[model samples]
Target: MRHLTLLGGLVLGLAVAGGAQPMTAAPATTPLSAIAALRDPAGQVIGTATFRQMGQGVQVSVEARGLPPGGHGMHVHEYGRCTPGVDPATNTVVPFGGAGGHFDPGMSRNHDDPQAPNKYGHGGDLPMLNVGADGVGRATFTSDKVSLTGMNGVLNRSLVIHANPDDYKSDPSGMSGARLRCGIISRNGLTTRDYPLPGAQDFPEGVAYDARKGVIYTGSAVNGTIYAVDAASGAVSKFQEGGALGRRAALGLKVDPQGRLWIAGGAQGTVSILSPDGVTLKVLQTPDSPNPYINDLTLAPDGNVYVTDSTRPVIFRVDPDLTLTRWLDLGDTPVKYGPGINLNGIAATPDGRYLLAIQLNTGELWRIDLRSKAVQRVMGGLERGDGLLLDGRTLYVSRNAMQVVSKVSLSADYGSGQVVAEEPLRGLRFPATLAAVGGDLVVTQSQLDKLQGGTPETPFRLTRFRKF
Candidate 1:
């Protein structure tokens, strides 16, 4: 926050956080501090912010231009997403609305100074900025309310510059004016990545997240061993050995609403139904076939479990009681695979009327009518669509080979789709699957390309992106 005087002179300069003199130089071994670029809804990069560790606290330098001439409130927002200033229909000040409110870890929800370090103000609240007549401003200050490391760290959070000045005592953020720009903070220009199952030859082909349990589940595609990952800590532990887990490879996983862990046994031609405690209660084997590969499974609101068979041109169905049967042989589309793998990812519509499945080898998205058991190709050429997830009308397809997540919008008829956007996740080694926890999406970096060449010391990890 700026230290102001009666003369209206902007009085804040870059200083060491703990009141000590600013360091003349960063150590050779010490890496550079964090940085972020604030962009408005129109995708204009209007401001830049940096975080540097100083004597007592983290020092933050903020520089922006083209802002209102005078004081404007600045703070970190809760969400990383930066949305437009107005709802097209409402025409209200929704600027950076997707970034949510101030970063209030606690529900205090008040707007106060970060220097106070009290429960009264939000931790995100910072000093107001004073733009000159030129509409440009640069100020640096330290905050005791934030840290460069630890759980309360600012990484991945959104930095926002507001339109109006902060009164310093308003109930919520000094009733700060609409957000003008926002940028997600990060270190070394890196994305939010967790792990690649982190070990030599560890390929996590599938990931299943249980929001209720606060746990994520995945397994080794090579040995069919199941492991549990701590969502908060990134800790990995062996949950179930391969002895009881059916099949040669554990490919896909889903945590059903009933708390059961449904696993697909790739190449084993079966699905394993396990208790929440990791006990294999039953194994539902697909009908006898030359080569049956149950690749993935998703639970439908209609109380049925749907499985995708990559080798067979069929969608397998498993009842709540563990009874397995051929729900539909989607013979409408021929099998287009290289190594006996085709249909890989499956998702059920919220209305429970249609099933959307994507073929791995061909990148074809097919919509299957649940009632008639008929299949229709909605679109094709997704380029290695491995995991398919539906949230409302948006379908997120993870193209493993292309190393990108394509977000498609489904038409009202559910028979067609258009690529709305693509999240180019270049950091992903081999993202095989995706799961949504809350509004955030987590991707499993199976690193199959590395693992395929045989065991190496590099471990695989998960990459996460927050939407809200």
Candidate 2:
């Protein structure tokens, strides 16, 4: 019998060719690394995985198609070949000769087992692949320990599917049954149809929620594309594609009390206000700056719009007359990147007496006293803080680094804070923005890479989380 090894403890056997059937060639000779696709004989893509470098670790996204509805186990295996059947007489199916054996570059063993814990196995063991009724499974995730540069490079190994779901801690096979499918990671980019639309190539630095219009607007970093998503149905539409603003890539989006959408074009140092109907109303140029790279903005209760320059660590107050005033200079915040303070997500208290800004690079959450302009760190060590929502005395923060959401109770002083909720929402992939409607939390899963079953590569996804 021919066998294949994969990430975790999965093993697969390929059926030998018989009669008119062609022999399953020794898994292709492609270099097993990078992002690649697995396709069926008919040239239909079955799945895809992308390997990325994050910090000192590796992040991979697997999306699959043409599977039974619901969840299925997925993992990287020890070997790359999938041979058919087994020799019952020996009671051993190829004995690791085919797939190899759990990828143990470190010679570690077992899953979450205290004996080995972090030592054994490669970073490819995954939970079941959840497919919708339409038989599509999509997911994005990261691993801090593995690399996908090449076979010996980390993913150069093999990938396999199991008959049963992985318990995540089982040794050998995790008690999961026979192997169902197998593939090898090749150096050349995997072939795949764009599943989910890739997120704006540049960072989606700022997001805004317009409750009355029930729409969300976000700015991209690369090309000038302003995304308008319907709050009711999560339908996304593009407005203003190829203009000066389009070329500049919008950054932050805010809604004025008068119900107009204001966008900061980071590339051009310009601000464009859009009507409720998604039409441009006016454009204002930022004064005293070249290439402002506007980061975050919020409308104050005092009827003025406050904008932050990500490149210079400065905040400007813009009046209705387009007059600009230097509100605060945050250059001394003990964190560098000056203008690029990596200052991204921003929000304000209902009373507008306090504003919250998240420093993405430093993972610091700062509360600014509007009156004194004093900035205090309310919390720090949050990963890739991207979105913020304030409801009553509670604050909701999205941590893209850890791929989770957290809720904290806010004190009048913005000091005594307590964590209220922190849980993973299933099927959430790279959540970048959030909106709350009538107690329900709406989140956007910008599936940023190809996974087992994501569509259009990195398509946008919406999920609802109910708060009790």
Candidate 3:
């Protein structure tokens, strides 16, 4: 069978039949855990193993069937490949020889006991795996020498099962015989910390960060209550009362350079601008007769605010002087608005000459030229895209229904892009938006999918994904 290797961080599987997938530098991971599926020479998956972080050590569990009924050796190999190759020492072909030798990040070159320290033994050394009469073997243990992340991490490594038992004292491989099965290790998810909100059913939707005061701002989808969280302590406080100034629901939020909050009034067809002191400075609205659902907004470099209406095929713009106007209408262009939720998230290019928005139903990205009033569909699919954040030429799309964050690298003109990575971050439950604060990604767990006559998780929280 064909084999595909898994790389840690931003890089995932290798090239498949169609074409090569885009890859980039690895992202920072902490206390990472992994799992592997053991495959025999015939490409048949026979077993599995799991690795987890527990305190300062790593816990390992392995279970396999259809093996010899005796003691066998198991080790974390140096490489992540499971294909056959020529053995350097034997000058002959070896089963699963591509995995290389035992993992020895410290370069100790010793295959001592697992209980020994890293300086004295290889980090991959473990106790012998004993098989029963039913050809089933299982082992569970903890090791302090190896880690799941960092320099000594094994996320992109390989696990191998040897034919003979380990002697615990022999050099190189403890007199273990030929390798029988090998599996490539892959990461499960990034570690996360939760910052809970106050109400049991707040259903927080949007997130924004104020660097000056080191605070995070989020709003409630249920009643438009805006809450501020201290970046250093995760302390939650009310920033604005719910449903103030005829605003029924709050969705997307952005903190301007002047520290004023630009709030989107969902389904109210209005946009409210509030000062840092929680006082409403101004409110803008669209025509109430046709009805509109203002879902998200973005701040441009020229100090203009662009908003997206989910129900209507139109975009509204608010000038720096607080003057609101109908910026662009998709009905007048080639872009078609589907039946369900249309445009959800809005973001502008750094040059302020173009704006990019996502259509949830069609999963299409549209680019609008501010200078020419021209609109064109960007080349990429981001279905279920809820929030959009642009950092230089890279765009981050939060897919709420898929429970994944897609990293897209845009071209120079912002007309085309490709998904470089899609990470399913841990502790995210129906994530609605994303905010970069102090090198960490703050994501809101809106839980909106379960809001149909069902009880939401108590004390809904925002998660901090530690990504550098």
Quantify all predictions' global Cα lDDT against the true fold. 0.72, 0.57, 0.78
Alpha-carbon RMSD, each predicted model: 19.9, 15.7, 16.4
Q: What's the true lDDT of residue 313 in model 3?
A: 82
TM-score of each: 0.59, 0.58, 0.64
What count of clashes does model 3 give?
0
Score residue 124 of candidate 2 by CA lDDT: 55
Instruction: Determine which window of 10 residues in candidate 2 has minimal summed lDDT.
Output: 9-18
Query: Local error of candidate 2 at 298, Å?
Result: 1.1
Ranking by TM-score: 3, 1, 2
State which candidate, 2 or 3, has the greater TM-score. Answer: 3
Query: For model 1, how does the per-residue alpha-carbon lDDT over 169-287 read when each residue is reduced to its tens digit?
Result: 88666866777878887654233546446445557888899888888888778888888887777777877876574455788899988788888898888898888988888888888
Q: Clashes in each model (backbone N, CA, C under 3 Å)?
A: 13, 51, 0
Query: Could you tell which candidate, 1 or 2, scores higher by TM-score?
Result: 1
Q: In terms of lDDT, which candidate is strongest?
A: 3
